[model samples]
Target: MDVWEKCRSWTASQLQETGQDCYYQVISDTFDGTEVTFADRRIVMAASHDYLGLSADQRVREAAMAAVRRFGTSLGGSRAISGSLRLHEQLEEQLAQFLGQESAAVLPSGYQANLMLAPLLDKDDYVFSDLSNHASLDEVIRLGEAKERKFLHSNMKHLEELLTTTRAGAGKTILSDGIFSVEGDICDLPALTQLAGRHSAYVVLDSSHDLGVLGPKGAGAAEHYGVQPLLITSALSKSLASVGGVIAGPAEVIRYLRFHARTSLFTAAASPANVAAALAALEILQTEPERRQRVLNLAERLHNGLRALGYDTGASTTPVVPVLVRGRERCLRMWRKLCEAGVFTAPMTYPGVRAGREVLRVTLTAAHTDTQLERLLNAFEAVGLAEGVLPEAGPPREYAPVRITRPTMATSTARGEEP
Candidate 1:
């Protein structure tokens, strides 16, 4: 068979390996916060991005409804045309203040936000990105047609080396995820920003998973690390419980993007309801710091429990936790077992993560209760042991002297007691 036909045949093997429809699902009872009912089977949702639980907030819902009542549903054209509204401007201003930025612009989606920001780079510019940066950013780099280099994930030395070797006068832009989605590790933003300053490079941080969940007041990884990026991009759909994206930076840059961002100029603007909902969610994020703490607390509990059970959760220090399952087939089995036991989680396979480093990404939210968390813990413990992902339940053993020459070859190096 030809290459295309051979690849097409591999689709069947993938389906058999992963079990069909692992991603697509419909939850009945839309307002349910921590748990979802699928086909009459209730499951604790551990694979969602609603970190602040603002998606089900009454105030947010009411605000959205109010917007719909006042402005109707759709904005017929792009923001630059006839789609702009008072609420859009209000949301941008509020986001700027919340994120400690000089200005902000709202877009149709987070993917679009990156897509628009990318084209700002000229032919004489170069883009440097972390290896684990989001797919959107990678796509943007390709679309922008700029010379690019990918540094090792969170490796400042590699980035610095690349910067030192680049053409002296060429403009440089660094793209990275403030909090990696699958690994759930915060970027070394302070070091990255320092390097950017030294090399005259602009840093663009994708804080989609960090905002409304990271930092003391949920100001994102930049605030958590006490560093500032040249531009910040995020998804409101994740924590703000809305259906749009935001790009925030200095006023002049935002002004330029407001006109040059073709996605913003060509696509319809975010609905008034989404803008109002995001505004409400932002207010809640500001007023209720406890909500952020709750999510973090739950995450810590889950992480500790998994560790105690001798399960490998790799380098996670945030609400998004990845249970390392190693191989694709093993991860699929673990995920299936968890789902059957009433815990829902998403699996990360090749391309989403490195080969042989598959994991189940479990996201925690403020709305998740103690009972729910305990149940999830139990499910993970049971399923992990059953699938050989963890050692058999037994007393923890003292660490043995072992050397890891290559960090990439090692698995589950996060804090743990050997079993």
Candidate 2:
């Protein structure tokens, strides 16, 4: 066989032998409130991103239905062509007002928005990205030939060091996630903004996990920290309980993006029903501020309870909490045990998290009751203790120590290897 055929065969063999397979266990019924039925059991969902639980709200459903009746289903063309609808315009306006921005442009997905934005900036520009940024943002930085510098996760000091040391020729931009999806730790936006300003760098904040979950009125991390960036991007899938993405920023930049961003110009716009549903969800978010507070309360409750039960939930302050299992086998075993106990959770492994740091990610929603929370806690404790995955008491031992050695300056021709 040729080299190509040999490589292909090897790839297939590797996948068959070593791939950790994931299968979608079928569900038989609709999602009602906080419960979902699969087979003969009703599992309490602790894995979804419906932070404020607006996905099943009557108002949102009604709005979606109304839009379906009026506009049918899909937008036949991209937004630049014939897909731009009145509903889109309305939602964009509402989002801009809510985010305190001059303008906003809705995209097909958060992934696409991130992928499209980095390429639009000139190649001479340098993108200072977070080391632990989401895969989508990482892909953009990698695929585009933009000069990329990764700083330690959420470390403002390291970011400033890079900014100060970088050559003046490159146009600088700092990109970070407002709320890290995995660690659940929030970015220090105030410090980041100060550094960016000092270095004359543009800032791009991705609030995909923070939107509708952080801030005073769920305006996101920017509002929480009182720092406005040059660009803000987020997804509607998580908090809005819909499907789409939005980039909110200055009007001129938005207009420029509208003309140049191929993902927005070429791909079909979001469905009419989804757009209307998101708008209604936003309306609810605006009027019912207590919903956001309730979700926060539930998150706090879960975090405290989990910590008390001797699980390692690292530095999380948002609705997303991760039970650090640290090994792939252990993480999968915990997930299977939880599933058998009628509690669904998403497990994070290998690429999603760092190697030797796999975890079981638990997300909280406002619709979940106190009883459900207690049930989840019980299941975790039972499974963790029974399987010897978690300790009975005391903090976990350090995994491994890292040693840092500074590079020493060498004189020219001292080693006699190179001039």
Candidate 3:
């Protein structure tokens, strides 16, 4: 065989041998709130990020259908050309207001937003990133190649140390997730904001998992901590139960991004139906604060219950709860068992998490009823105990502990003043 053929054969064999196969499974019918039917069984869903549960809400559906009736499916051209619609503008305005910013730019996807923003910075600039940031941010850093330095996950002291010591001239951006997707721990935004102020750095907040799940009014981490970021980027796909990304900041920054960001300039804008759906979702979020409270209540119940049942649910303070099962095979086994018992969840292994610290990532939605939450708790308790995977009762072991320390502000040299 020639070189190309040999390479293809090797790739295929490696995938097969490593159990890295990717395929789609068809759901028998539509998802009913927090339950889905597949393979002649009804499973309670614990793996969704639909925090407000607006994905199947009647008002959201009606808005989307109305848009579809008025405007067909596709946008037909990029946003700069014939794709910019009134709905897009309205959504941007609403998002800007909701995020407490002067303006916001909408993108097709959160991944694309990250991909576009990183390359916009100059080569001489630097990015101070968290070591355990989402893969999208990792891709951004790799693509930018802009003097990247990583602080330990959520370690503000380490971040400040890097910022003070690095010699990368003027432009510095601190990028982090407001709420980590996997571990579910909240970021110390106040400390980060103070550090950014001390170092004269711009802060970028990715609130993909926090937008509709945190804060009193579900306005996200900035509102939760009373800090305004230089730039705030998030996905509507997760908490908003829609499809798109938003980048909110000052008006000039948004205007510059609209004309220069590769993802916004090159790709077609979001379809009218999706834009409408997201708008409706936002309206519902503003009107119904109960949905947010319900999800938080359910999450707290689950977290406390799991601890009582002797399961190591890491330092999670949000709706994204992860049940730690140490090995890859054990994690997969627990996933399969949970599925067999009519509870569906996603298993995290290998590249998704560290090698030996696999887990079953369980997320909650507001649509989940009290009975459904109880059922999910029962299923986990049963599966964990039956499989002998539950840790012994008492103080839980630290599966992956994150420690954050604040940095002292530096004294300025001019006239011995503290800036």
Estimate TM-scores for all models.
0.90, 0.89, 0.89
Highest TM-score against the true fold, candidate: 1
Worst 10 residues of 2 by lDDT: 410-419
Error of 3 at 43 (Å): 0.4
Give the number of the best model, judged by lDDT: 1
Worst 10 residues of 1 by lDDT: 401-410
Cα deviation at 99, candidate 2, in Å, is: 0.8
Question: Per-residue alpha-carbon lDDT of model 3 for 287-351, expressed as tens digits?
Answer: 99888878888887777777777776787778888888888777877787888888888787767
In candidate 3, which residue pairs get closer than 3 Å at backbone N, Cα or C atoms, i.e. clash?
A: none
Runs of candidate 1 exceeding 4 Å displacement: 1-14, 17-20, 393-419
Clash-forming residue pairs, model 1: none
Q: Write down the lDDT of every candidate, Cα atoms only.
A: 0.82, 0.79, 0.79
Comparison by lDDT, 1 against 3, better one:
1
Candidate 1 residue lDDT tens string, 40-143: 88889888898899898999999999999999998888879785898999999998877778899999788988887866777889999999999999998888
Q: How accurate is candidate 1 locally (lDDT)?
A: 0.82
